[model samples]
Target: MHEKTIAELAAALQAREVSSVELTEHYLRRIETLDDALNGYITVTAEQALEAARAADEARAQGRAGPLTGVPVAHKDIFCTEGVRTSCGSRMLDNFVAPYDAGVVERFKAAGCPVLGKTNMDEFAMGSSNETSYYGPVKNPWDTERVPGGSSGGSAAVVAARLAPGATGTDTGGSIRQPAALTGITGLKPTYGRVSRWGMVAFASSLDQGGPMARTAEDCALLLNVMAGFDRRDSTSLERPGEDFTTALDRPVKGLRVGLPKPFFGEGMAPAVARVLEEAIDHYRGLGVEFREVDLPNAGLAVPAYYVVAPAECSSNLARFDGVRYGYRCEDPRDLLDLYTRSRGEGFGAEVQRRIMVGTYALSAGYFDAYYLKAQKIRRLIADDFARAFQEVDVLLGPTTPDTAFRLGEKTDDPVSMYLSDIYTIAVNLAGLPGMSLPAGLADGLPVGMQLIGNYFDEARLLGMAHQYQMGTEWHRMAPGGFN
Candidate 1:
């Protein structure tokens, strides 16, 4: 039961071959037995899960079950789950239990899916690797000593290990796709505004978008069907017509035009990862797909521009967590100033503080024009580059990361190198385009992911392409040794 995909589990429930309770119990047991070493989940809502499962079973009997009825899933800790701790993997919110469900969580609940629990993430979704998670880093299932990519690492790790068939994740400059690539799973970052940000802890508001993570593209489409929609509550939500993401999975890729960004294939990629991506390109060519070199000349500016814009936005969004209203507070204060200083100093981790300071400096009165404004201009250039490239291709393809998973603690000291881990993925967010990562092959025994970048709101096409590739390959089906 734990080994099945979300679709398979739903089928079993509809056939009455297994009860929702049985499925829930199986996953709960897996989480209990295997999660200690991985530290993938920050919380486990066993009692709540059983109750939800019982309700799903009742709903099935009444003919009121939805498409995802009785399907259990995991939510990233950054999402608010009513009455469950939505700590965002930070000490500041360690004791903060949300009073409301995030928009994505609500949709899943409406679909009758039971929540497995919250998965750990980087402190406020700030790190490339999961090391910054206050709860502890989530270990990659493929190799325990290696790091799972962040800030969706926990969600990716659990899904990769078969602890959950699918999970929710947020992408802010490659949070979802990068980790999915490292863990050998599928993750999607929908076009900005396709999904609501309501109740999701803000991180670089302009770049953050919620999406799905799972073992396969077919599963991601199903999850996205529930996750994507307009919300009046979130001003950033787009009022676009709803889409059935899974509908495109059956489409053939006979003449799909895929663009390979020249910048993506340039210097810096590890030889092994490049080899795997080359093999993926060969596989796609065999599928009757045509590949062409497209220029995203300003793509080279993505990293620098993103570091400025993201932190600037994050600085503004995180300002709400002061010592006064909620979250962590100093036990005693010498004065109000001391309370504010001590509380924040103790609450935020080193990485979070580093970003906050950098953001504050960038947005400061004297530096605004010199730093933030210039970064925004560079951002426009990057987006224009994507716009020009799309005119000649149906989709853009590239390696999701420069390399496969590195050992934990390997790049923590060099923040610059750590930031570059997202070199291939950050530009998509800057352009507000939909991007996805699918397992391509292994490099040095570690999973490598090939990314697909789509035009705005063109996720269906990306899903279709991925599903087609999956049909002819076994990468997504291969599980880690002990996980089985």
Candidate 2:
């Protein structure tokens, strides 16, 4: 029961082959049995999940169930879940129970999906590896010794381990897609503002976009259909009409124009990843898709530019967590300054503190032009490069990460090495385009993912492209040993 994909589970539920409570209990049991090792979840709402499952059963009996009714889903802790502790994987908010549901959470609830719980993440979504999580790092299901890519690693872990059929993840510098690659699942980072950010704790306000993580492109489509939409409450939310992303899954891939960024194939990629990606490209070529080398010349600069832009924004967004209104407050302080300093110093983890400091430095008065301003110019150039490439190709393809998942603690001491893990992915976020990671194959016993990047608001085509590949192969269906 726990091994089923979301679409299969939804069908079984509608056909009355299984009750919602029973399905929910099966997953709750899996979490109970497996989560101690994975640490994928920060909070488990078994009681609420069962309650919601019961409600879903009632809805189904009355013939009012939607496609997602009674399906279980997990939220990244960054989203504010009313009445639940929305910790954001930071100690500062460990005790903070949100007063309302984030737009994504609310939409899933409206679709009758039971909330599995909030998953762990990097402290304030700061790190590439999940090790920086305040709750503790999320271990990849494929190999427990390795890190499950970041910020959204916990979300990916839960989905990969079959603890949840699908889960929500946010990408700021490849948080969602990277983990999906490492964990051997599918993840989509939608176009910026494609999903509402209202009530979601801001990471890089300009870079953070929420999307779905699941086993297959079909499941991601189902989840994305629920996640993307216009939200009046969010100033940045696009006002596009609701879309059914699943509708395009069966579209033919023949003659589809796929771009291969020259820099992507030129250098920096591990041999194992390159080998698998080449095989993946051949798979697409066999399907009659045309591939051409396109130049995203400024893509190589994305890392430096993103570090400047994201951290600068991180510094500003994280300023709200001071000891004044809520979150952690120091026990005793000589003055307001002491209170602020002490609370933040003690509450945030080392990585979060490091980023805040760097961000502050980048956004500082004199350095603004030299660092932040220059980085923005580079960001514009990266976006322009992608825009020009899109004019020639319907979508672009590349390695999701430079390589497969690294062992835990391997790159922790060297921040640059850790930062480079997202080298290929940072450009898409900077450009605010939709990108997805689907398993290409395994490398060194770990998953190697191939990324598909679509033009702005072209998420449906991206899903279709991936679905076409998934249909030809079983990579997405392969589960980690013992996880099933």
TM-score of each: 0.99, 0.99
In candidate 1, what residue range of length 10 has the lowest lDDT sum? 1-10
Quote model 1's TM-score: 0.99
Tens digit per residue, CA lDDT, model 2, 354-386: 888999999898999999999999999999999
CA lDDT, every prediction?
Answer: 0.94, 0.93
Cα displacement (Å) at residue 136, model 2: 1.1
In candidate 1, what are the lDDT values of residues 135-201, reduced to their tens digit?
9999999999999999899999999998998999999999999999999999999999999899999
Candidate 1: C-alpha lDDT: 0.94
